[model samples]
Every structure is written in C-alpha cells, then in structure tokens.
Target: MEKTPSACAMQWNIELERDLRSKKPGKSIEAILDIGPRLEWWSRESNLHAAEYKIFGLIPGEDKLFANAILLRLADAFKSGDKHMKICIVKIFLSELKQRRQLRGQGRKDEGILSKDKVDSYRELLTRIKIVFDSGNIEERALALVLFGCWAHIAKDSADVRYLILSSLWSMHILEAKASLFAAGCISELADDFAHVFLEMLGGLLVSSETSRTIRLAGGRAFAKMWCPILLADIAHKTGVNLILESSEEEFSLVMLVSLSKIASKWTPLIPRQVELLSSFMTKDRGLSLQVIALKCLRFILTKGMYHFPANSNVTLKLFGVINQLDFPPALHFDALRVLCKILPPNLDTIPCTEILTIFSKFLQIVEFKLQSPVISERVFAIHVLACIFDKLLGILKDRSGIGSIVSSRMLTFTFDRISY
Candidate 1:
C-alpha cells in the first residue's frame, strides 16, 4: 500500500543533507535517529520514491530508528500479510540510498554521524523496542525480536541489550501466543528469520576450550528452558519460512563472521545439534556452501584457541577431516593450507617444503583476496599465517628455488590476476 513519494520529501532529504554536512560546527547525529522509522512507515503506506529511499538511504544510518522502522513496518506487514509493504519499504530504502549517493557526489557528508553517538542512541531506542515486545501486538513483538538480533551485531551498545531481549522472548515464549499470521489461508510466513544467523554467530564466537564449554552449557541451558514444547524449541523458532540465503550482505556478513569467529570456541559442540535438526537444508548444490561454513567455523576455532590451547595439534587433526572434506574454490585452498601450516608439526604430516609449495600453488587466491584490508591489524592474520609458509619457502628455495619463492613473496603479485572467462 506504499504511495509514491512527493517531490517535496525528495527535495527535503537533499536539503537536509546539504544543511547538515556543509557546516563547520557539525550536525548532531542523534537528531535524525527516528527519521528512518518514520520514512519507512510512510513508504510502506505507498510512496514509491519514499519506499526506494526507505531501504536505500535508511539501512546504513538507521541505528535504533532503523530498527524501529523495521519493527513497525514488519508488524504492519504481519497484521495485513502485505507483500507490497515489504517491497515498498525495501525499494524506498534503496532509492533513498541511490539519491544519497547522487547527493554525496555533489558534496554531502552522509549523516556525518559518529559511530559512538549512534550506538548511544540505539541503546535508548532499544528500551522503547522492549516495551513494544511486551505489549504491542504479538506479531509486532516477534518481528521486533527478529530485528533486534539483526541490529545487535551492528549496534555498538547492542550486545547486552540484544541478548536480554532475545532471552526474554525465549523465557516468555512470545511465539506461543499463537496469534497466527495468515495471508492466503496459510499461517504466518514470517518467522524468527534471524535465529539461524545469531546461532551461527554464536557458533563462530567460540574461541577457547573454556569458552566452548561455557557456550554449550549456555546454549543448552538457554534452550532447555521449556514452558511449552511441541509448539516450539526454546526462543521462538521460525517454523514458517524456510531460511535460505536470507542473509548475504558482504560487509555485514564479514563483520558478523569475524565477531562470531572470536567466539567460535564456545559454539563447536552446539553446532552438531543445530545441523542435525535443520536436516532439510542439506541439499545437492549446497554441499560447497556447507563446507565453506564448516571450514570457516574450524578456522574460527583454531584462530581463537591457537594461543592458549593445549591440544592444538590434536584439535587440528580431529578437525582435519572437516577441512580436508571441504571443497573450496582454488582461491581458498592456500589459506586452508596456511591454516594447517599454523598447527602442523614439522615432523608429522607431509614434508614442510612440499606441503608449503603444494598449498602455495592452490591457496594464493586466499592471500590475494585477504590482502586488501586497509586496517594494519586486520591484514595481520593473513600475513602471520602466510609468514609460516614463507619462512619455510625461503629456507627451502633461497638457494634452490628462488623463482618459485618470489611468486610466493609478500608483494602478492598474484593479486592482479583476474579470473577472466
């Protein structure tokens, strides 16, 4: 039911950008905290232009306001089972983003907002959202909880608030209210949608043996609380929509992956159960996808436990089956080898030289892809692992294989090679 945007709103946005960014004193990032929600609600009512910017301009700067807008619109969509509203909201955001970029080209400092101020704003906004979770209609509450998880990763103040909200939903069993969302005589198509993501995230963050045990205990304890059973399995599980590829934004995914990887040690044992129950997802073409997820999980496990871990070598070998079974594009192969290089004892598996060269032949793609991080710290992980191989390569080839060693050098000359068809 979203309407088309008026010329005025479009112009207002442009003016707002110009007014805020062109100043010497600078604009308050908190001023427009709620604009994202307002624009979204209006866009869902039918502004095609509003709808476009609703998603486009709104997503990056949304903070708490963005979450509110999403919650409100999702509630509305749930009540009406309206597809147009979803489409409208997304379109508006995208369109707004497109417009913002156009304006940026002409000199506008996008929200000029500092991350700290925005996180502070989101905390207050989260308080308001919790009230909605308890009293706003059930569908609205459920939808709010879903968004809580999505925004939790990005929102600076989001950690504790996100966990509590999701925990409260679990303890309360909001999904059991059974209000039932239906559009075409079917039950609500809306589901937790964010649960799998948070779960995967939780899995990724488990880094240490101590954290691993704690996470399983925490996950089990959390899920074990069952005031109601058949209708659910702790925290409102999204029974309706089959979750597949719902989350894939590059920047966001990377953020979630890295953070979760930090906590991956806690998630390992908890994963088998999640993987087992969600058996339907184990399809044909998805083999590669699953392997990627598994290896990434394993990589996360090693990265976290590497320092303090006592059984580092055994953990590597036990998980070796998972890594070796994985089917990555040749691009990822080198890092897989590099990861192995981190834990592989010089005397155990294959000769260090042959292993280094063999993996270097394959894993250069990982090196090339990972080398682009602008942050000195972020690039360090790859460099450190690649260093292990380079040390061995240098020793073996400094006298024997100088040409081969240069190809594997830090310059990453391999990076410029595009995979042309």
Candidate 2:
C-alpha cells in the first residue's frame, strides 16, 4: 500500500529527529538533502505543515554544513520558485537570521559569523528580494517588508532600504496587519536621525484602532526594544496623555499606559495630571478584566514607576467609589485596594484623616454585610482588606494626635469585631 501523507510526514519527522540525534558525522546533512525531493512533493500538494517543518528544521545551527546548505536552497527557491514558495523560503531565512542574531548577542557560539563572501552573496540576494517586495500582491509585499527587517543589518547603511520601509510604514493602505508589524520590528534598525519620527509613529499606533490588534501588540513589544527611557520620556512628552486616554480600543490604551509607566522613571510633570484621567478608567463602561488592568496600571505607577502619583484625596475617593461598584468578588477588589494603599501612605497628610476613616468605615459595612452570608474565600479576602486598612490607619493615627478620636475607637472596635469571626 502507498504511504499516506500523514504517515509520510510522521516518518519524515522521525528520520529528521534520528539524524539530528545521530553520532555519525554527515548524517544530518544527509537528512537535509533528503528534504529536497520532499519539498517538491509537499509544494505540489500545498502542505503548510511541510512548509513550516522545512523552515523550522534549519533553525538550529548545530551543523553549519546542513544549515548553510538549507539556506542556500532557500535562496535559490526565492529566485526560482513561485510566489508561495518564495514566501515560505523567505520566512525560513528570516527566522534563522533572528535566531542567529539572538544567539550571537548573548555571547554564545553561533553559526560562525558570515564570511565576507557570504555577506556579499546575501547583499546581492537582497536586490532580488526588492523585486518581490515591490510585488503587486500585498501579502507577498508584506512578507518581503518583514524579511527586509529580518536582514536589516545587511542594509543598515542603505538609504534606499530605509526610504522603502519608512514610506511603506507611512502609507495608509500598505499590508495592514503584517507590514505594520514588520515595520515596527525594524524601528531599531532604521537611522537614528529618524528616531523621533519612529517614536511618534509607534506611539500613535500604540493607541490607534486603525492598526490590527496583532500589530498593536507587536508595536508595544517592539517599543521596549527600539527606545530607552530617555527617548521614551521625550516621546511621551510629545504624544500627550489625552491621546492615550481617548483611544478607541480599551485594551490597546491599557497597553500603552503600561508601556509608558515602564519606559521611564523620570516624572514628566504631565504624568501626575494624567492620573486623574487614568482614574476615570475604573469607572468606564468596561469589564472586570479591563478594570483589573486599569488597577494594575495604577499600581505600577505608584509602586514600581518612578513618578509619584499626586496625593489627591479625590483620587482616593474615586477609587473607593470604584471598589463599591465592582461586581467582582472581594479577591479581585484587592487590586483597587492595593492601588489606594500605595497612594495613602501616612505621609499623605494632605488627604483629610476624617475622609479616610469614612472610606474604611464604609468598606467595613460592606464587608460585614457580606460576612453575614459568608463565602470562605470572600471572607478571607475581606479579612485581608480589613487588616491592611487597620494597619495603615493605626500608623497614621499614632502620628497625628487630633486625627484619633472616639470615632476612630469605634472604627477599631468594628474592625476587631469582624476579624474575631
């Protein structure tokens, strides 16, 4: 009986793994050579798994001979194969290039540096790549643009390459998903002279719904790679917080907020002012998950972030309001309380102690009511919140003489009553 494609694929994986594991020299190269015929057969059947395998097989550089031979075949395919074949081959080369660069950057022994001749060969191959990049087909063009970013170092000094990529990025209609992702990926490779332009562009996309989620997500990931804190701070200064706050996509805006807090320790004066706007997110018509994300953003800003959140009593008041509105259980409410605590350090005497006590008393009432129909988990979370609030207030009351009164004693008694349960 003829072997099924499924069986053939399985046998092929087994043989490749065996060759990869074999102690015999040249056996891996033999296994790679065996792929040439299979490539033709797989291409005839349009088998994506086979195509994916072909690309992944060349990722490890354990055998330079096998890897180089596979790379050369892929280049040949790029030149001679049909469009689908070209795309698959280029993707393989790009993935291998990234793996090699990552390995080299970490000071690991890599597929030894490309020889001068090999460098020249790749540079020449790039001329052919440009033809596909300018292809009429959008997907092919998108993939080609990504390939350019992958091999960006080869053409780092080439003005023509920079213009081609930048113009594509600026174009409104270019590969909507992929081209943007690859373009963002190449921002670090683009000329430093255009660094501001790239930052502004990425910042805009970081909040824009016009970009695909994958591309926006990619933009956020690439933001860390392309710019440092100083540059990021400068970009945030230029972009303004309102743009991020008014973003049509809630998740994307939250990502931008997280990235902003992470990128710099320096408080741009505008950042504290923006916290009011950010606080409003807790009250937005959104889900608990999104509210959780906003709470995390606030926590990041107050705790890990360098900027000091303004000690406005109103911000605390608004947060407590959010806690009251939260439909989620007490456990999830912990995030909001955590953010409140970060802002409510004993030093924040600007916020009236009376107002603070009222907030805690209201929360105790809610906890006491819930305790009447106790869920063990919710009850535990309620206890945790009560402890944090009491501990915080105890420290403040000891420092401020007039702040502790008969009302404070009753608040303590009420808290202790709940805890005894």
Taking the candidates one at a time, how many backbone clashes does each contain?
40, 0
- Please give the CA lDDT of all the candidate structures: 0.38, 0.57
In model 1, the runs with Cα more than 4 Å from the true position are: 1-136, 146-168, 171-260, 264-294, 300-335, 344-421
Model 2 stretches with alpha carbons more than 4 Å out: 1-128, 151-157, 170-178, 189-191, 199-229, 237-240, 244-274, 284-293, 299-311, 326-332, 341-343, 346-350, 362-378, 405-408, 419-421
Give lDDT tens digits, candidate 1, residues 193-276. Answer: 334433443333322233333333333223221112223332222211112224333232223332333332344443333322
Measured on C-alpha atoms, candidate 2 has an lDDT of 0.57
Q: For model 2, how does the per-residue alpha-carbon lDDT over 1-421 read when each residue is reduced to its tens digit? A: 4432323554565566576456687664565556545533432332224444455443322223332343444454455556665565555545555665576556654233232222445656567667776664676677667766666655555666666776666456536345645654554534465455566676666566576666665565555444344555556544645555555666666666665554432454545744665666666476566666667767766664444556676677667766676476665466666676566664345557777667667767756754654467666666666666667767667767666664477677886785688
Local lDDT at 385 for model 1 = 62
Q: What is residue 75's positional error in candidate 2, in angstroms?
A: 4.9
Global CA lDDT computed for model 1: 0.38
